[model samples]
Target chain A: MTAPLLRIENLSVEFGPRANPIRVVDDVSFEIEAGGSVGVVGESGSGKSMTSLSILRLVPEPPGRISGGRILFDGADLLALPRNQMPDIRGRDVAMIFQEPMSSLNPVMTIGDQIGEAILLHQDLNSAQRRKRVLELLRLVGIPDPAGRIDAYPHQFSGGMRQRVMIAMAVACNPRLLIADEPTTALDVTIQAQVLALLKDVRQRLGTAILLISHDLGIIADSCERVVVMYAGRVVEEGDVRSIFRNPAHPYTRALLKSIPRLDDERDRLYQIPGSVPLAGSVTQGCAFRARCPLRVETCAVDRPPLFAFGPSHKAACWVTAEAAQARSAAEASP
Target chain B: MARYIFWRLADSIPTVLLVLTLVFIAMRILPGDPAIAALGDNALPDQIAVFREKMGLNVPLWRQYLNFLHGVVTLDLGRSLISNTPVVNLLAHHLPYTIELTIAATLIGVTAGIPMGVLAATHRNRPADSAVRLYSLVGYAIPDFYLGALLLIVFSLNLGWFPINGGGDDFPSRMYHIVLPALTLAFLKSAFMGKLARTSLLEVFGKDYVRTARAKGAREGRVIYRHALRNAMLPLTTGLGMSLLATLSGSVAVELVFNRPGIGTLLISGISERDYAVIQGGVIVFALFVVVVNLMIDLLYIVVDPRIRVQ
Candidate 1:
C-alpha cells in the first residue's frame, strides 16, 4: 500500500507556561492520503482548527506551543526539520486558507500582487511569468474580469470574492495539501455553497489533499470521504464519512448528529447537547465527553477509553461501544 | 486629485484670514506699545508721542486693523518697528536657517525613529523593546529647551566639538553649526516618531494579512518589510506630518539655547522689541507652513495606499 501523504501521531498543543499548561490539542492522531480529503468536525475550541495549525507549525508562539507531536509528511518528520527549511516546505508543499475573508487579505495590496507573492516565493517564475500565473490563478477561481480585478484592493471585493482571491493565493504554488480553517463560516449560506463548490473544483483540478476543519457536519459530509470527530481536544470518533454519519458509534458523535436541524423531522425544537465542551486544561481525567454523553458508563469516570475498532474502518473512544464490539466479535467467533 | 488639492487650498483662505486677524489684534492687545517699546522707557513723553504718531499708533484701532489687512493683501508687511527693516526681508534672511534646521531634524527623526520602532516592535518584550519604550518616554517627558541646553553643555561647552553661537557664514560651516540644534530637535521628535511607529507596527503585525503573508512561504524579513511595514506606514505618515509642524514651531526653544539666527530667534527678538509687523508676518508664514504640510500629508496618503485614491 502507498504511504499516506500526511500522518500525525499523538500530536499535542499547549498554551501558557509549561508547568501549568492548557492542552488545546491532546494526543490527536489522523492521516490524509495523497490527493484525498479528510474532514475534522467539532464545535468551537474542540481543537479542530488547532490541529490544522499544528500541521503547518503556524500556531501563534509564546502563548501557543506544540508540546508533543510527530507530524510525518512524505515519510519525513516535519517536527524535526530545521526552522530555516520550513519556509520552503510551507507554500510549496502545503498552503492554508483562513477564516474571516474580509481580514485575511492585505488591505493595501492589489489582488494581483498578493497572488503573485506565493508564486514569487516558491516558483522560479520571472515577473512576466508571475504576472501571467497570477492572472491564470485569478481566472481559475472564477473571478469576474480577472484582468480588471487584478489591480483591485481587498476592500473592493465582496466577502465571497475576497475568499475566492484567498483561494487563488493558496493554490498559486500548486501545493500538495490545502488546510482550510472554517473557510465558509464567514460567508452567507448561498455564498458558502459557492465557496464549497469552488473548493471541490480546485481539489478535483489540482489533485490536492484537503484537511478541512469546520464545525458544520453538512459541509464535512458533502466534501470529505472520511471524518474525524473531536470532543474537548480529543478525537472521539474516526471513520469513513458514510459509516460515521449513518451509524455514529460514540455517544457524543450521536448527539452531535441528532442536534442538526432536519427538514424532514417534525420536531418542535432542535436538539441540543446538555453541556458545552469543557474549557482547555479544565478536564484532566476520565472521558472529556462524559459530562455531555447520554450513554456514558460509570467506568467512564474511572478510566479514559482508548479507541476500539467497531468495524473495518470505524473506531470510537467509548467504553459502551468498545464492550459491545468486543461481545459481538466474541459471539460471532463462537458461531 | 488635482481638484481635491484645489479645493483644499481654496478652503484654507478663511483659516489664513483668521490667523492674520488674530495676530493683528493680539499684537495691539499686548501691554507694551510698539513705539514705546522701540523707543525705550527712558524717552521723554513728547518724544514718545512723536514716535507713536510716526508709527501710526495714534490711528483708531479699527482703522489700524483695516490698514494691516490691506497691507497683508498687498503682500506688504511694512517694517520692523525696532530695526525699520522690511519684515519680508527680515523673514527671508532668517527663514533659510529655520528651514534647514527643521528639514535636518525631520530627516533624522524619520530615518532613526522608524527603524527603532520597527526593531522594538519586532523584538517585542525583549530588552531592546524595553529600551525603546524607555527612550520614547524620556523623549516625550523632557522639554526641547532643557534637552537642547544639556546637549550644548555636553557637546559645545565640554567637548567643544561644535560652535556655540549664530548660524555660520558659509554653507558648510552653517551645516556644521546647525548640527547641535538639529540633534536636539531630532532627538526629541524621533522619540515621538519611534513611539508612534512601534505602536502602529505592533498593531499591523496583529492584522490577518500579516499571517497570510507568513503562510505564503515568504521569509520573516519579507513578511515584515513588504506586508506589514506599508500598512503600518499609514498612521506613521500622520505622525510624521505632526512631527514636521512640531519641529518647525518647537525650534524656537532650541534656537534660543543654541543662539542660531533662525526665524525662531527672530520671532523671540521681535516679541521682546514688540515689533508688530515682524510678529504678524512670522505668525502668518508659520500658519501657512502648517496648512501646506497637512495638505502634503493628504496627498502622500494617496501615493502610499491606492485605496485612498479610489475613495
Candidate 2:
C-alpha cells in the first residue's frame, strides 16, 4: 500500500576537481520498498560508503561532489532539496550509523545527552519528555540498566555497546530510513551477529527501511533482503537475495561470491577474486573490472557494458555474459 | 586528573628554580664589576672595591647563592640598585603594564588566530585560505620592532589617534597606549597560531569523528567549531602557553620603541648600570611568572576540553 521508500536513479559521484573528476558512483540505481532491507556489499574503497554518503549528502568536501544524481525518496527529489532544508530532513526523515562505534558517539558527551541532543534538534519534545524518550531509546536498543548507564561516556562502553548507543541515537526520532554504513565491521563475529540481529529487530519494530552497507557477504546475507554489488564505484550486479545468491551474473559478482571461504569447500585452495578494486582515479576506458575479469573479450576492453536484466529482479553489467556462460558450460561438459 | 595536575605542578617548581639559578650565575659570572659599571669608567679601583663590599659582592659564590636562596624563600626581592627602592616595589609598579600588554596581545592572538585557522581549514586550498596563510607569512616576515614603529607613526603620530608613548598618568590613556604595542606583539604570534590552528583543524576535520559528525547531519558550523575545532585547539593550547610567557618576557623591544616603562626596559637600564638588585628581582619575578603561566595553561587543557579531563 505504501509507495517504495526510496528510488535512486543514475546516481554518479565524483571526487577531485570539476576539470577531471574521479568518478566513484557511476549511474547506480536501485529501489527500497517501505520497511524493506537492502545490503550494499563491497570492499574498502569500493564506493559503498560513498553511495550511502551521497544519499545523505555527507560526502567529504571540495574535491568530492555529486556530479550527477537523482535520489527520489518516497517520490521527493532528495538532490533537489535546498541546502537549508537538508538539516530539517536529516534525523527527521532519515538517519545513519557510522562504522567505528568507539569514535562515532561523541566521547565528551553522556550517552543520554547525545541521544537527547538529536531529539531536541528534530523533535518538539520538552526537557522531561526528552529525558523519558532518551531512556526509552536506550532501553529499546537493549542497553541494560538504561537509567544508570545514560550518563556514561562513550569511553565507558565496549565496542558492541557503543554501537548500540549509536543506533539509539540514530533511531531517536524514529526516522523512516536508517543507513548503517559498515555498522558492525569493527566488532567480533559474535558481536557482529548480535548487532545485525539488533538491527533486524529494530526494523521489525519500527518499520524502518534499512540500507545496510558492509563488505562481508555473511553480514549482507544475514542482515539484508536485497543485495547490490559495487565495484569500482559502479553497481556491477543487483538482485533479490535469493536470485543473487543462487546465480550471480557479473564476473565481479561471481568472483566475490566464490571468494567467500566455505567450510565444505574442496581441499585444494580458497578462491580469490584475483585483482584489487581499481584505483578510482585511474579507471579510464571500458569496464573498470575488465583487467581482472575471467570473461574478458574484445568488447570488454573497448566499451563499457550497461546493466542487462537476467530476471525481473536480477541484473548485471558485463560485456560477454552470454559467451562466458556458454564457455563455462562447455568447460563443465568437457570435464 | 587530580594526580595529573599535581604532577604537572610538581614538574614546574624545578623549572622555576633552574631558571633563577641560571639567571643568578649568568649575571654574577659575567666579567664586569657592578661597582665600576655603576660608578663609571673614571672611578678609582679602591672606590669600586668598597662599593662591592658594601653590596656583599666580596662574599664567595656559595655564600651569595645561599643569601639569594634565603631571600627568595622569604619573598624578599630586596632593593633596586638603580631605583634605590625595593625591587618588589619597582616591579609592582611596572609589572602591571607588561602584564596588561601581554594579556591584550594574547587575547588578540587567540581570537584572531583561532577564527583564521578555522576559516583556512574549512576553505582549504582556496583563495580565502591562501590569504590567511599569506597574512601569517607576512606577519612572520615583519620584525616586531619595525611593526611597532610603523604603527606608532601611522596610528599615533600622523593620525593623532593615541598617545605615542607610555600608559600616561590616567589608567584609560595608558591602556590605550598599550593597545598598539599589544597589536604589534600579537601580530607576530597570531600568524603562527593561525597557521597552527588551520593546519590542525584541517587534520582534525579528516578524523573519523568529524566524518561521523557530518553523517549525523550536524550543520557545517556545528561540525566545525563544536566538533573539529575543539580537538584542533589541543595543540594550540600548548603552543599558546609557551608563547604567552615569551611575549610577556620579551616586551623590551616594543616597550623601548614606544617609551613604555615595562620590566624589559627596567631590566635593560638596570643591567647597563650594573643594578644587581633590579636584575635579580626582574629575573626571579619573570621566571616565576613564566612557571605560573605554564601551569595555568596545563590546567586550562582540561577546561577547553572535557575529554582531556576525562582521560
Candidate 3:
C-alpha cells in the first residue's frame, strides 16, 4: 500500500521550561492519506489546536515547544528540517486557516495584496501575474465581484467574505495539506455552512488533503471521512466517522456523542459531561480521562491503557475495550 | 480628506483668538509698562507721555485692543517696544531657528527611538530589552535642561567637541552650534518615542494579523516591518504629534541653557524687557504653528491607517 501523505508519530508539545515542562499534547499520533480528510474533535484546551500548530512548527516558542515528535510529510521529516527551510515548506506544502476571520486578515493590507503575498513567497511570478492569480483565486473561493473587491481592505468585507479571502490565500499555492483550526467557530450558522461547503469543494477540486480541527462533531461528521477524538491531549478513539458514531468504544467519546443536542429527542435537559478535562501536567498517573469516565475501572487508576484494536481500522484507549478485545481473541483461539 | 482639513482649520480659529485675547490681557495686567521700560525711569513726565502716545500705550485699553486686532488681521505685528524693529521681521528671523531645532530633534528621535523600540520589543526579557528599557527610563527621568547641562559639560566643556553658546551666522556654523541643543532635546523625546514604539509594536505583535503573516510563511523581518509596523504606527503617530508640540514649546528651557537665539529666547527677552508686542506676537505665532502641525498629523493618520479614513 502507498504510504500516508502525512504521518505524525508520538508527537508531544509542552509549555514552560524544559526542566519542568507542562505537557499539553501528549504522545498523540495520526495520519492522513493523500487527498483524504481527517477531523480532530476535542473541547477547548484539549491540545487539538496545538497539534495542528506543531505540524507547521508555528507554535509560539519560549512558552510552548515541541518536546518530542516526528512529523513526516511525503517521507521527509518535517520536524528535522532546518529552520530556514521550514518557510519554504509551510505555504508551499501546507497552509492554515484560523478561526477569527476578522482578526486573521491584516486590516491595513488590501485583500489582493494579502492573497498575492502567499503566491509571491512560493511562486516565481511577476507582479502582474501575481495580481491575475490573486483575482483567479478570489473568484475560485466564490467571492462576489472579485475584480472590484481585490483592492478592498479586510474591514470592507463582511465576516464571511473575510473568511473566503482567508481561504483563497491559504489555497493560493495549491498546497498538498491544509490545516484549519476551528475555521468556522467564529461565524454564524449560515456562514459556517457556506465555509464548510467551500472547504469540501476546495478539497474535491484541488485534491488537497485536509486536517480539520474543530469542537463541533457535526461539522466533522459532515466533512471528514476519518475522525480522531482527543481527550486531555490524548487520542481516545480513532475510526471512520460512521463507525465511531454508531458504536463509540471510549467512554469519553460516548459522552461527547450524548452531549450533542439531538433534534428528535424529547429530553428536557441536554446531556453534559460530569467534569471538565484535567489541567495539563496535573494528571501524572493512569488514564487522563478517568476522572470524567463513567465506566472507569479500578485498574484504569493503576495503569494507563494503550490504544487497543476494537475492530478492523478502529482503536480505542479504554480498559473496557482492551478487555473485550482480549476476550474475543481468546474465544476465537479456543474454537 | 480635504474637507476634514478645512474643518480642522476652522475649528482652530477660536483657539487662536482665545490665545490672542489672553496674551493681550496678561500684557496689560503685568506690572511693568513698555514705555517706562524702553524710556527708563530718568525720563521726565512729559517725555514719558510723548513716548506712551507715540507707542499707542496712552489710548484706552479697549481701543488699543481693537487696533491690535486690526493690525494682526492685516498681517502687521507692529514694532518691538524696545528695539523699534518690525515684530514681523524679528519673528521671521527667529522662527526659522526654532523650526530647524524642532525638525532636527524630531528626526533624531524618530530614527533612533523607533529602531531601539523595535529591538527592545522583539528581544524582550533579554539583556538588550533590559538595557533599552533602562535607557528610556533614564531619558524620561532627566529634565531637558539638566541633560543639556550634562551634555554641555561632557561634550562642550570637557571634550571641547561642540560650542557651549551662541548660534553662529553661517549655515555650517549654525548647524555645528545647534547640534548640542538638538541632541539635548532629542534625548528626552527619543526616550518618549522609544517607549511609545515599544508598547505599540508589542501590542501589534500580539495581534492576530501578525500571526497570520507568520503562518503565511512570511520571513520574520517582512512580518515585522511590512505587516506589524504599519499597524503599530497608528499609536506611534499620535504620540509623535504630542511629542512634536511638546518639543516646539519645550524648547524654551533648552534654548536658555544653550543661549540659542530662537523663539524661546525671544520670548524670554521680551518678557524681561516688557516688550509686549514681541511677547504677544511670539505667543500667537507659536500657537498657530502648533495648530497647523497637529492638523497635518491628523491628516497623516488617515494616510497611514486606512481604518481611520473611514471614520
> Model 3, retained fraction of real contacts?
0.66
lDDT of every predicted structure (CA atoms): 0.90, 0.85, 0.90
Q: Model 3: what TM-score?
A: 0.95
Candidate 1 chain B least-lDDT 10 residues: B32-41
* Lowest summed lDDT window (length 10), candidate 2 chain B: B209-218
Give per-residue lDDT, candidate 2, residue B100: 83
Predicted complex 2: DockQ: 0.41
Model 2 TM-score (2 dp)? 0.92
RMSD of each: 2.0, 3.4, 2.2
Shift of residue A279 alpha carbon in model 1, Å? 0.9
TM-score of chain B of 1: 0.91
Identify the leading candidate in terms of TM-score.
1
* CAPRI-style docking class of model 1 based on DockQ: medium
TM-score list, all predictions: 0.96, 0.92, 0.95
lDDT of 2 by residue, A235-291 (tens): 888988888889988888788888888888885788887767788857767888998
Which DockQ-derived CAPRI band holds candidate 3?
Answer: medium
Clashing pairs in 2: A16-A63, B167-B174
